[model samples]
Target: MTTLLQIDSSITGPNSVSRTLTTAIVEKLREANPGLRVIHHDLAAAAPAHVTPANFPSAHPISAAAGDAPEFAAGRAASDAILDEFLGADIVVIGAPMYNFSIPSQLKAWIDRILVPGKTFSYGAEGLKGLAAGKRVIIAVTRGNFYGPGQPTASFEHVETYLRSVFAFVGIPNPEVIIAEGVQLGPDARQTALDKALQQTAGLNAA
Candidate 1:
């Protein structure tokens, strides 16, 4: 059976555009592929703690000292759990809203926990070889202003770009980005953008 990991990191709960769109995508996917197992991760309310100086050393497991510090041990354990989740997933869908031109802190924390060296990815003869192979990723991004076309808003789209690049570096490439841009640009624009995104999302085939 296909397994999907749905992650929503919006603070606005059910009202968030990204969350709604991601949910829509998941629903459509379920309809297309029956008997699919879905796991939801609401990161906004249940955010993983940021890796601090105390736990930072554990990020590099090989470089850490003989014994793990209390905080470092906690961080390692947390990361291990997340990595297990990632390894088990066949597909990952993320609902990410742009905050200060970047993804929310919760999403970043999740990424930090999952992207472990010698685990998710590793240095290869050519460069990096990601361990999580053949997994598909879908990202639903919501923006307050018009962030496409020739505008300064486009430059501020670090959230989507960063997610794509980082995940691609770890071997998940060509992720489908269904964006609801100009959401806060009044009702008309919001509806238009959302309608367009929905159309695009509906056309997406499972990878």
Candidate 2:
């Protein structure tokens, strides 16, 4: 069976546009692939802690010092589990909403866990190479104001750009993206953007 990882990091619950888009995308994928296994992680409900000196060694096992704190051990275990989920999934769907011109801190924390050096990427004499390459990534992005290409504030757009760069660095270069931007401009713009995003999700290919 194809394993799908569904991640939602919106704090707004039902009012989150990114969450709605991700749900629709997942439903579409399910319709196309039977017996799909889904593993969901709701970052808003159970947010991962930001990386600190205590837990930072989890990614670099050799750098771990002796006599670490109990909390550090627990954080390492949690990060290990998160990395395992990412490695196990054949497809990943993310609901990422823009917060302060970037992705939510909860989502960033989750990212810190998955982007381990030896696990997802590595460096060699040739250059940096990504180990996790085959998995497909689909991102559902929502921003209040317009920040797309050629927009007045496009330079401020970080959600999609950052996600693309991260995923590319980890070996998935061309992630499928569905965006619902300028939702806060007006009711009409919101509906239009939502409808367009839903249509994009409907047109997505199956795993």
Candidate 3:
């Protein structure tokens, strides 16, 4: 059975294009494979605390007596749980919307948790080696305006680029990114972008 971990971080609720597209992607994927199991997480409602120095993990395990506060300990546990979920998933689908040219705070918090040193990546003689390889990542992104190559606001966009770099650092160098751009242009443009994204989702193959 294939397991799909779908994460939605959009705070815009039903009006979020990324969220809708992510659901569509999952449904289309299920069409290709009937036994696909999905684990859905809404980060906006259940986001973990941000990574702070107090809650940071050490290369070696730290005991509770090592000066960690109760809140910090709980935060650490939450981070560990997020990392475990990512490690267990075979496929990851993310609904990421651009907020002020970057990703949402909730998604960033999740990234901080899963990007653990020894689990997701490690430094070796080869410089850097990623442990989480062979997992497929699909990102559904919604941007307010156009930011493709040679566009005026291309330099201002960081959501997709940041995610690509993060996933590549963890061994998924090339992820399938479906984008709905110019969503703030107008109703027609928003619908067009969404339609195009749906087409991409429908064309996805079973992993």
Candidate 4:
């Protein structure tokens, strides 16, 4: 059976536009593939601690930080689990909202969990070689203002580009992105952008 992992990183709970769009896409995916196994992870509700000295250990035993002795091991274990989940999945759907012209800390944490050395990728004689293959990813992004690459507000697009670039590092090329921008501009613009993004989701699901 096809396994799909759905992740939501928006702090706005269900009210987030990116979350709403991702939900719609997931619903469509479920309807289209009833045999699919779906796993939902909400990062906003369960924040992951950033990597630190203890979390980033060498091949040998290392000293632990106060109150972080257990956390260091737990963090590595969690990252391994996430990496396994990604390796087992056929598709992944992520909801992301722009924060300071980049991805949210929660999603970044998830990325750190999945992008591992000698697993998802490895060093090659030339540079790097991604081990992961035959997987697909869809990202739904929401922003307060309009932003598209080469547009006036393009700076806001850094998050989407960053995700695509990083995912590609693990051989997940051509990640689909649905953007809902100009939400905070006004009511009309918000509805319009959301509708457009929803339509894109519909097309993605139909495909």
TM-score of each: 0.90, 0.95, 0.93, 0.89
Better of 2 and 4 by lDDT: 2
Candidate 3 residue-wise lDDT, 1-96, digit = tens: 788999999999999999999999899888888999899999999987776765555332442335666656666766677788898999999999
Say which prediction, candidate 1 or candidate 4, comes out ahead on TM-score. Answer: 1
Which has the greatest lDDT?
A: 2
Arranged by TM-score, best first: 2, 3, 1, 4
Candidate 4: worst-modelled 10 consecutive residues by lDDT: 57-66
lDDT of 2 by residue, 1-207 (tens): 899999999999998899999999889988888689999999999998887756653666542653476757877777788998998999999999999999999999999888878899999998999989999999999999999989999999999999999999999999999999988989999999999999999888875
Off by over 4 Å in 1: 53-63, 70-72
> For model 4, what is the error of residue 138's alpha carbon versus the real structure, in angstroms, after optimal superposition?
0.5
Whole-model Cα lDDT of every candidate shown, in order: 0.83, 0.90, 0.87, 0.81
Q: Point to the candidate with the largest TM-score.
A: 2
Please give the ranking of all candidate structures by lDDT, highest first, separated by commas.
Answer: 2, 3, 1, 4
Task: Report lDDT (Cα) of residue 23, candidate 3.
Answer: 94
Model 2 TM-score is 0.95
Instruction: Summing lDDT over every window of 10 consecutive residues in candidate 3, give the lowest-scoring window.
Output: 56-65
lDDT of 1: 0.83
Clashing pairs in 3: none
Writing each residue's lDDT as its tens digit, candidate 1 over 87-203 gives 799989999898888999999988877777876789978898877778889999999897776986677778888999878877787888899888888899888988988898889
Candidate 4 off by > 4 Å: 56-71, 205-207
Candidate 3, residue 191: the lDDT equals: 99
